[model samples]
Target chain A: MKKVLFAMALALAQTAWADGGMDILKSQCSSCHNLTGPAPQTLKELWARKGPDLFYAGNKYRKEWLVQWLQNPTRIRPAGEFYEDHIKPGEKHDEIDPATLKPHVSLSKDDAQAVADALMTLKPKSDLIAKEKIEEGTISKSMGEMVFDKFLGCMACHRIEPDYGGLSGPELYTAGDRLQPEYIASYIRSPQAWDPKIWMPNKHVSDMNIQKLVHYLEALSQENKNGK
Target chain B: MGNKLIFLTLLALSLPALAKEAARDNYRTYCVQCHGMAGNGKGVNIRDMSVQPRDHTDAKAMSARSDDTLFKVIKEGGLSIDKSVLMPPWGDTLSDDEIRDMAQYLRTLCKCKFGGN
Candidate 1:
C-alpha cells in the first residue's frame, strides 16, 4: 500500500512537469508567442501593431479568465487594441466567427494546464499593480449616481436606464439585475482579470469611490423595480 | 449696472476655458471602436458582439446619468460599476485626471448632460 501511494505521488509530479514542460509550450504557443522569459521585444511591437501586447500574459491576467477569453475572442476593448483611426464615419469593419475562436479548439487537461502555467510567467517591464489604500465613502443613492456620471465615468460604456454614456464599454441598464456588489467592486478596481487585452483607459479610483459606485450600481435593479 | 453686465459677460466667455478638457485621444485609443467617433455606440466592433452597443446620442438616456456615475464607470469599469462584463476596467491604464478629460469629451459628443439634452 505504501509503495502504491509513493508511485501515485510520483506520477502526479511527473504529469505536472510534463504538461508545463517547455517542449509543449514551444510546440503550441510559440508561433504567436515566445515561450522563453523576456519575450522578444520585436514580437511585442508587432503584436501591438496588429493587436494587444501579450508579453505580460501571466502577471496581467488571471488563469481562469485567460482560459475563457482565449476561447472567446470578444472585443473587451471597445476600440482596436492598438489605435483608432477613423477619418471618416460609418466605415465598415469585418466580423469574426465565434465558432473559430481558440477556446473552441479542444485541448487535453494536461495540455491546457501546461499552457496556462507557461503563459502565466510572462510579466511586463513596467509595474502595473496598484498598492495604495483607496478612500472609502458612505455608500448612498444620490452619491452613487453622482459618482457614476460625474466623477468616475460609468456612462461612457454602460447604458443605465435613463442615461447612455458610451458604447465602447457595455450596457449597465440592468446591472442591479446582473451582478453582485462585491463582484462589481473587484471588477471596477481591476478589469484585466476578465480580459488581458482590454483597451479601456485605466483611471485610478480610490477604494471609497469604488464602493459608493458599486453600492449605487447594485441598487439600479432593485430601486427601479420598487419605484424608488 | 453696465460694469456688472460686462463682468458677467467676461466671466461667461471665459467659462469654456475652465470647462473640463476633453481627452479625445484617450477616447480614440480606448473607446472609439464600440462607441464610435460620434458616441453613437455603433463602433466597428459592434457588429460582431452578441449585444449591440448602446447609442450615446440618445438624449433620454444621457439625461438620466450624472457626471459622477460616468466617472465611476470609466475609472472602475462597466462590471465594477454594475454595468457590463464586456466593458473592462480602465482604472489601471489611465489616471483620474485623464478619465475626467475623457468624460468631458464624451459629454461633447453626446451633446447633452445629466438634466438637459
Candidate 2:
C-alpha cells in the first residue's frame, strides 16, 4: 500500500515538472491535432469524419469546460468507432488522485489560461465552409447518402444509408433532425466514453474539419426538414 | 496473329497481379510488424499503439476511395491522407513503385475496383 502511494506521488511530481503541460501536448497531441492553421486536407469534413478537430478551442468551448474535460474525458460518439474492437464499451478513467496525474500534467492556474488562450487562436483560414446555413430544407436525404458513401467512410461501421457497411457504430440516417452540428462537431474530434467499455480508436480530428462536415450534414438535414 | 493478340492480353492482365504479389511481399517484410499480414490491422505492434492502425479488410469502406487516394495514403501516411496519425508514411523507406504496388495489393484485399487507373 505504501509503495503504491509512493509511486503515485512520484508520477505526480514528474507530471508537474512536465513543462507546465503544453509541451506534453505538443509532443503527444500533434499526432492527431494541430494548434495552428492550414490544416491537413485529409482533415475530417464532418460528413466523412472518423475523429474530431480542435482548431477553434476558444470559441466552441468554455474555459471551465475545457479544464474539466481535460482532467476527465467522456465518450461523445453516439455510434462509437467504425470498427468494433477499437471502441471498448463502458471503459472510463477519472482523475488519478491528482497526485498520479500531477506529475504528468502539473498546470498552474496561469499556465492553464495561457494554454487555453493559445488554443483559441486555431480557426479555419477560409469562411467558405464556416458560413454554412443551417436553415430548414438545406440538408437533403441524397446529401446524407453522398456523405455516407463518398467523402467520409461512414458506411465502414454505420447503417445510415442501409447496407452500406458494418454495424460497428449507431445509425446516422436521422442525424439530419436528431443532432445539432456543433454537438456533432465536438463529438467527432474527441469521442468521450459513451459506454466506457466501448472499443473505439481515437482519431483526434480538428475543429475546422468538423465545421465543414457539420455544414454538410446540417445542409442535408435541413433539406430533409424543408421537404418534410 | 491471333495467338500474339491473346498473349498480349493475358500478359497485360497478369502484370498487375504480379506487381501486387511483390507489394504484398514487401509489406509483409516491413509493415506486417505493425499493420498485420492480412491488413486487418492486428499487427504485433498494434497493441502498443496509442491510435489503432486501419484495417485493410474493410471492402466497402476501402472501395469508396480512389486508387490515387490509397497510393497517397501509403506513400504519405494516415496523417497525410488525413486519417490516423499513427500510420507512418513509407515514402522515405519504400520506392514509388513499391508504394503503388502496395496500394494495388490493398485494393485487392478491399475488393476496390472503382476509379480509372
Candidate 3:
C-alpha cells in the first residue's frame, strides 16, 4: 500500500516538473503552429498552415537563435508562411498591413529558454542533418556574392543585405547567425524535403556549389557581426 | 441600342488601363525589390549586386529592345536571353497575359514603344 502511494506521488511530481516546457508550448505556440512531424506536402496543404512547422526545430535552427527569437520574435518570412493569403496589393510592393499582422508571442527569458529546450527535443528526422563541419572563410565575400547573385539568382527571393534582395523569403544576410550550417546546406540542397510546398525551388545545385554557398553564408554572417 | 454600343466602346477603351493596373501590381509584388520602387536600377539590392539592374526609364537603352524580347525576358528570365542570371524566371509565378501586360507597362516606364524608332 505504501509503495503504491509513493509511486502515485512520484508520478504526479514528474508530470508537474515536465509540464514546464510542454505547458508553455501548449499555451503559447500551439494555436498557430504545428508541433508535430509531416510538414505540408502540397501547395494546398502549405497554404492551410498558419505558421512554419517546428517539428524539425532541432535539425533546422541554432539554439542561440531560437532562444533570442523567442524572447523578441520577428517576422522571418516576408510573404508570410502562406504568401497566397498574406500578400495584398500595395503601391510599391505587395504588403502585409502592419496593423493587421499578428505579432509573434514573446516570452520571458526563462520561458524562452524552457521553450527552446523543449523545441530542441522535437527531432522528427534525426538522420536528415549530417555531421558536417563548417569551415569558415572557405569562400570570399566577392565570390560568394557572385555565386548568390549571378550564378544562382538566390537574391530574387532571399535578402542578402538588410536593404537588398527579394521580400518573398527570409532575409539571408543574417543566415549565418540564424541557422545551422548543416541545415543551410541541407535546405539549399533540397528545400522540398524539409517543406515540400515551399516557395524556394530546388535549383539542383551541385555538391560543390552547395558547400561554396554555405561557406559564403558563414562568411557573410561573420562580416555582418563585425559591423563592416 | 446606341447607348449600349457607347458603353461597350467605353469598356473596350478601359480594358487596357485595367490590364496595366494589374501589371503594375505584379511589378510591385515581384520586381520592386530589385528594380526599385520607381523602376530605377538602384534597388535596395544594388549595393550587394555585382551587375546593376537595368534602369527601366532609360529610353535610349529600352528603345533598342523589341517588345517580344522584353516579353521573353520577363517570362523566361535574363538567362533565357543570355543576359545576367540575377533576373529570376517569373514564368512560374505570373500568367502569360500578366507578362504581356507587364511588357506593355515597361514601355510606359521608358515612354518609348518598341519598333517606333
Tell me each candidate's TM-score.
0.40, 0.31, 0.64
Off by over 4 Å in 1: A1-27, A30-52, A65-106, A123-151, A158-199, A210-228, B1-117
Which tens-of-lDDT digit does each residue in B13-95 have in candidate 1? Answer: 87422222237655666676667666787665554344555567777786677888878887776766666644656666556
**Chain A only: TM-score of every candidate?**
0.46, 0.33, 0.85
Give the higher-TM-score candidate: 1 or 3: 3
* Order of candidate numbers by TM-score, starting with the best: 3, 1, 2
Task: Using lDDT, give the best candidate's number.
Answer: 3
C-alpha lDDT values of all predictions: 0.56, 0.49, 0.74
DockQ of 2: 0.05
lDDT of 2 by residue, A100-185 (tens): 11112335565554455455444452243243333333335466455544544444334443333334455454453444455466
Every model's DockQ, to 2 decimals? 0.12, 0.05, 0.09
**Model 3, stretches more than 4 Å misplaced?**
A1-19, A131-137, B1-117
lDDT by residue for model 3 (A13-119), tens: 65554467767887778767888867764445666777888878878788888889889987776656555455444554345445545778898887877787777
Q: In terms of DockQ, which candidate is stronger, 1 or 3? A: 1
Question: Using DockQ as the measure, which candidate wins?
Answer: 1
**Model 1 C-alpha lDDT per residue in residues A91-161, reported as the tens digit of each score:** 55322233332332445655655665656665542243333222444456677767876666556455565
What tens-digit string does per-residue lDDT give for candidate 2 at B18-109?
A: 22226755665445444554567665434323466666778767777788888887777676777865554555445688778888888777
lDDT of 2 at A70: 48
Candidate 1 chain A: 10-residue stretch with minimal lDDT? A38-47
The TM-scores that each candidate's chain B achieves against the reference are 0.73, 0.71, 0.79
